[model samples]
Target: MAHQESSVLQLKQELLRANMDKDELQSQNVDLQRKMEERSQLAAEYKKELTQKEWLIQQLQGKLDESHRKLSEANYQK
Candidate 1:
């Protein structure tokens, strides 16, 4: 009877340790998911900003080309 009681106590202690390990793993998983979401949002914002800058660069190049053509025409006429 003493041996049986000792075995039962040992099993209960193992079960408690398993439960604590499971809880810690679940907490870590939640934190990782939250960080992934934040990184995704930041990546989207950066992509949008890059697209806007590209469009502005194109507009500036078009204006520069037009100015160069006008200057050439004036010099040719002189």
Candidate 2:
């Protein structure tokens, strides 16, 4: 009977340890998820900025081309 009681106590301790480990793992998972979301948001913002810069570059190129054409026309008139 004493051996049986000791076995029961050991089982109870094991169960408690398992529960604690599970809780810790769950908390870590939540932290990782939050970090992933933040990274995704940052990536989206970077993409938006890159697109705006590309558009601005295109506009500048168009203006340069127009100026070149005007200069050529003026020279021809002279």
Candidate 3:
């Protein structure tokens, strides 16, 4: 029957549209996952840099303390 054929055609079109939508959503999901990985790597690099800076600051503080101690000793001898 023509009516049955028409119904089948409409159903097929709907199925095709649904498949396209699914493909688009999958692509978007993959993009989001890639961005998340990039951000995670950046965060790790920042953390490493921060740790290095903290170590440098501690080294400088130790040297400053040593200088102050020597200065105090020199003053006491005078």
Candidate 4:
């Protein structure tokens, strides 16, 4: 009877530890998921900013090309 009681005590302790470990893992998983969501939003904002910058660059390039064409024509007339 004493041996059976000892075995039951050990099993109870093990179960407690398992519950604590499961709680800790769940907390960590929630934190990681939140961080992933934040990073995903940041990535999307960066992509939008990059797209706007690319459009501006294309507009500037077009203006530059027009200026060069005008300069070439003026030189040829001279």
lDDT of each: 0.98, 1.00, 1.00, 1.00
lDDT for position 8 in model 4? 100
Ranking by TM-score: 4, 1, 3, 2
Most TM-score-accurate candidate: 4
TM-score of 4: 0.94
lDDT of 3 by residue, 1-78 (tens): 999999999999999999999999999999999999999999999999999999999999999999999999999999
When 2 and 4 are scored with TM-score, the better candidate is: 4
Give me the overall lDDT of model 4.
1.00
Over 4 Å off, model 1: none
| lDDT per residue as tens, model 2, 1-78 | 999999999999999999999999999999999999999999999999999999999999999999999999999999
Q: lDDT tens string, model 4, 1-78?
A: 999999999999999999999999999999999999999999999999999999999999999999999999999999
Off by over 4 Å in 2: 72-78
What is the lDDT for 46 in model 4? 100
TM-score of 1: 0.82
Tens-place lDDT digits, model 1, residues 1-78: 999999999999999999999999999999999999999999999999999999999999999999999999999999
Candidate 4 weakest ten by summed lDDT: 1-10
Deviation of model 4 at 63, angstroms: 0.8
> For each candidate, C-alpha RMSD in Å?
1.6, 1.8, 1.7, 0.8
